[model samples]
Target chain A: MKLSKSEVEHVAKLARLELSAEEADRLTTHLNGIMAHFEKLQQLDTEGVAPTSHVIPMQNVFREDVTGPCLTAEEALANAPESSDGYFVVPQIVEV
Target chain B: MTEYEPVIGIEVHAELLTNSKMFCSCPVEFGGEPNTRTCPVCLGLPGSLPVPNRRAIEFVIRASLALNCEVKEYSDFYRKNYFYPDLPKNYQISQYDNPIGRNGWIDITVDGTVKRIGIRRVHIEEDAGKLIHASVGNESLVDYNRGGLALMEIVTEADIRSAEEAREYLVNLRAILTYIGVTNGKMEEGTLRCEPNISVRPKGTEKFGTKTELKNLNSFRAVYRGVEYEVKRQVEALQSGGRIIQETRRWDDDRGITIAMRTKEMEQEYRYFPDPDLVPMNFSAGLIEEQRSLLPELPQARKERFMKEFDLSAADAEMLTSTRAMADYYEEAVGAYPDYKGISNWIMGDFTRMLNSAGIEIDASKVKPVDLAGLLKMIADNVISGKMAKTVFEEMFNTGASPKEIVKSRGMVQVSSETELYPIIDQVISENPRIVQDFLGGKEKSFGFLVGQIMKYTQGRGNPQAVNQLLRKRLSETKG
Candidate 1:
């Protein structure tokens, strides 16, 4: 149930978050506290309880395969931080 | 060097042939102006929710049923979090714990042995956008038009042991998917993509070695070559006392090698959780039955039926039933003319050659079933010789003209009557007295030369059978 500093750093890296040493150490303690609380909760006898992914009981919520309106290229790229030739520009990606 | 056994399994991702995107109403098309097919939901704009496409789900079910997968009654979508430029949402909605179908199997014939490869699971997911990198610099462009498109991932058990088996597995899988009308199954267009995880082990070892994944394999040939290269690389590494590392490798098709992309530690841990926006799917018995009924006869079954009913060889049956449209064309032509082998020959020979050369489907061609049947009937009734039929077919293919019309207009009718060919035969004999003397002097080739001359004199419209008979009679009468 203990959350280590390296685990926090790894998680941050996966989320594309750049965390300093101080922040990583602080988050480790904070996350460990949260994990301890969850561990305490896990100790209760709830073996028969059904696992629920969502609180809502909705099932088979689907839309028909009919196309509606779509955004123009200008509108789609309007909010992009950087765009060129109707495309969102990013730094060169070395790996896929 | 010790012999090693390689274990290979493939993961195929196919885009569903739906009218709209997976979670939005944007049209799901292959190519257009970049970013034009985007909507708020697909672009991952703030506060937008995703709604599943019904047809896409049905397509997954149909594919699962066709592959002999047990369709699950309950399935839910999960969000797999990752960071990539193509994934605008920073996550992909996919199935994790409960996929739509599981425990399926597909049978592929490798080296004349039927091997049943187990299907682990078939899940539905959304495709990310495409990234186009600039040729010379560290700059890339993203197009979200393909974002949020419906994709079905089919995972197979590690049953394949060779590159040829992997290729056969993909071929059969593509045929089945195309037959069910779920996906177009065009690998070249990037609709169907395959990745194989391969590992090598000592010949008698029961445990698997560290496996490396081959990615971005676009064609069956690429899959075959990629697996072959990876297996050999792994085997060589083991032989040199080098440890194998689990990693992701890209198939350098031009260079024909598997280049290391990233190590296992650098791989994303796709922290998956249930997406709160979309609800779970619960299939009713009626619904599953309806979807099952919608499944047409798949490729394997149709091939067997063709062999049984038409009395075709395995190769002929397989070639004729390669595609659904081709199979239907064959059936329709056979219905019109009851000569199974003749129809099979024409379809498998000239028909397929023309299709491959023109890069078109059978339905897209000008040659209709009736036209083909007419051509075959002409050949059967001796109205035109087989050699002449080839020319007539080309004319019909180019002009869309009927076989009868082409024959009549081009004066391609065979001269079969004895009364008509007798004088021509007599003239040929008199004109080619030297050849006649050569024939009388027991030169066997002179007969063929005279027949050629007679055919040339008749403008290639002579009935070869009658010409052969009459020429023999005339030569013998002169000899007597």
Candidate 2:
């Protein structure tokens, strides 16, 4: 069930992770351990048992069509790490 | 062509409409400042334990019952461990082994037929924050505004046959969620999301094939296109003797393609385990029944009623009942008129056109149900001709003015009295003797020209029905 170092590296690349060698090795073991748990699912007596997807016995939940409060410009910009006036400020990408 | 079959399943994540966050009292409004709505519970601060939102639980249960799902009286929460900046808690608190509902079926309309989509489970969970990828020096920013939002994951069995069917099922599910008032079902706002499981097998094959989970399809069109792209891609791969790999695909709405995002992970990917902080849920039988009774008339029943009572065609019924507000408006208009065909024409023709133009929904219209009723009544009682009603309708929509008041103020009322209409009719016959010759020469459409002339003389206020009667009677004797 263990993923090779190359496979671990490949997965990290796909996920766009900047993993160190140690982290890569650690994730290899973690991914393999996770795959092993799924392997146990193969042994369940699921031959005729249907796979369960939802747990609630309810349906047709709806709301009245109405508009609620929208965010104010001040409230919308409150949490930005950087902001100016009433908008979220980010580093400029285009050169003048 | 080797017989190929399509296996389809739907996963719907519905945001529970609550006044506050799932585990905190912070306002659960969308698009607030990144951290303005956050509290210790939603921010995942140390020593903050989440108390379940009772209303959220009830809403989920109500939704479950509406879908004919069996409610689990006792359920527990689990921790899905993952590492994402948007997820304040590295591990999300979700239901694993004991979800609140399971084994349900939802019927959706497809091509004038009802197709039942089996639901697998509906479980309560918390939503993560938003990650905005900025075009910066290679880093993305995380906004915690959406953290700790209540969400229910509705899983459906692979009972769908086509991408169109899958889209219909998703739309029906959204409609149900909105109708129950559980979620707003605003895909653009990310209140409701649909992830499709698609696979293709040899035709008539009983065994299932490898399925890929496609995500990021935020719109109905995207859901259909994503499933179609994946199905064709898988079928082509299998036909070429290439193995189908299980993976997670991201749907590109612009490109209209499904791109492989990452390899599909098994259950251990998140390292799920029961959370030690939260208590297990225990509900009484009465609570479940109460929640079930809270459900309103669902779309299927409403559609059937529209066909039976309103005598609407299948297509018109489908269009009208797609949303609750539209359907409600249609009924209110009908209640005012009691003339099914006339009301349908007004709603489907002018009402829809105005709504589309103003970018407003029926519920949000300034003109209320009584306003629509007033306009239709003016036409029904012949206080105003059908042609004059159009002008009054524009005034009603523009100023929220009642049809009666507008007609009285602008002197737009039709000449319904025979005494009032006969003078206009006599003036028209004497002015246009040649046009009457066309009517006598078997030119039936030319009668409309005479009506137009009569209407012009009355400044478009002539009672059309009276004018028609008078024109036919006087012209019958002048047939030289």
Candidate 3:
């Protein structure tokens, strides 16, 4: 299944990525090339093959709900592009 | 013109009461310096892998079982990809195709009729960071303190027919969650949230009209109002040949209207895919059974048992069992004193009043259940009159002192003995000669006046029963 140019554009829009026309065309071609390889695999189908989302053959990997140490606010905000009053500041997203 | 019925379903997102974040070990609590509760995994730092929280999953199972949902044997976690400032990860770990629980049902009562709401799914997800819009600048502050906390979303089928029914469902859902100790269920604290998506259909039509989801319904009253107003708006739109657009609307509480949220918000498309870092949850029958075993007596069962065991009215039993702590308090007090009616009366009356006026919950009150029962015992033992118990109760509530101490310190023992009350009754009879003559002259209400005088002279410490009897005898002797 080849991805159309518009589909790539839609994906880029949803991901908040600005793609120029050249970048969009390149993505569409690269995405279809990637999909063409998957198309080759669709030719061979084992009817009884079970669907699996995990390849590790594992389940129920969990951690006990015991609290450990947390990062200090200064350390947590050190990597932010902009910080103010111990908060990560972003452009206003909410209209109201 | 045909009548249309409003079709509504509610979604409740409750933060699980846990000690740590969903995927990390940061403490899960409210009101901390912003971002102090962050860890690499919760903040979605590169190279940090996510692990499931065992207790959080168990909490969801307990709540699902309480709602009568079937626990699935296996469920997978998905990454819901979206670009929002509040979500540091840009993709929230949630459940999509398979959730922890499914097909549960809960019963809510409205207009004296019990209605069952279908539980569509109960899935565990991580909470997003809180966004505080700045008042002075065109910027918003992000607090990751609430980020990655374990949250469960309980979605219901479109079974609610009216606003009142929707309100009842929310009330019942909150009670169940709080009773099971899964969540604090405080809407004002933002630990619990309710959203209802509403639509209307023609009376005989099988198809549903378009729906608009409502947000910012912070309280039960707001839920009711938002649903009521949305239903009206949809009906008006249909009547005027206007089509309802499927969008998300924000409830403007001050203006009491549901305004469509910005169109950008309407572009929310969560591309869901199973997350590779976390493994799928596989619940053994043994685990499910164990969770079911740990399910405490829910509100409905406790309410019924309270009515039967304590011989309380249904209303009183329901009130007592409204919250687990309050019900437990009542049971503990009853255990100490065993006067069911007396304890019930005090808790429902003055005790509840004190708790409300003090702006605290029953568990936070200074008055212990045993102490309250002790006060009731004092009234029963004739150590104090019912009138005097009020003053003693206030002291007990304020100081956390025993009833005996408060009564003794105040020297407010009841004058129950006839010998002690007789002199006071005689003094009242002689001092109130006009009331006596008024009584003898067939003005029987004047007897109540004489009794009031005696009670006043005793400083309201007169045992009502003994005072009534002794005063009657004293008036009979005076007539002779």
> Scored by CA lDDT, what does every candidate get?
0.91, 0.79, 0.90
DockQ of each: 0.79, 0.07, 0.83
Ranking by DockQ: 3, 1, 2
What TM-score, computed on C-alpha atoms, does each candidate reach?
0.96, 0.80, 0.95
TM-score leader: 1
- Per-candidate Cα RMSD to the true structure, in Å, reads 1.8, 7.1, 1.9
> Residue B199: error of model 3 in Å?
1.7
User: Residue B4, candidate 2: how far off, in angstroms?
Assistant: 2.4
Give the higher-TM-score candidate: 1 or 2: 1
On lDDT, the leading prediction is 1
Q: Give lDDT tens digits, candidate 3, residues B424-465.
A: 988888888888998988999998998898889999999999
> Which candidate, 2 or 3, would have the higher TM-score against the true structure?
3
After superposition, the stretches of candidate 3 with alpha carbons farther than 4 Å from their true spots are: B252-256
**lDDT of candidate 2 at residue B332, scale 0 to 100:** 85
Off by over 4 Å in 1: B262-265
Give per-residue CA lDDT, model 1, range B1-480, as digits (tens).
Answer: 788999998899999999999999999886679999999999999999999999999999888898899997889999999878999999999999999999999998877889999999999999999999888777899999999999999999999999999999999999899988999898989899999999999999899999998997888899999999999999999999998888899999999999998553457689999999888899987888899999888899999999999999988888788789999999999899888999899988887898889988888889988889989998889898888999999988888899999999988999989888988998889998898999999999999999999898888888888889888988899999
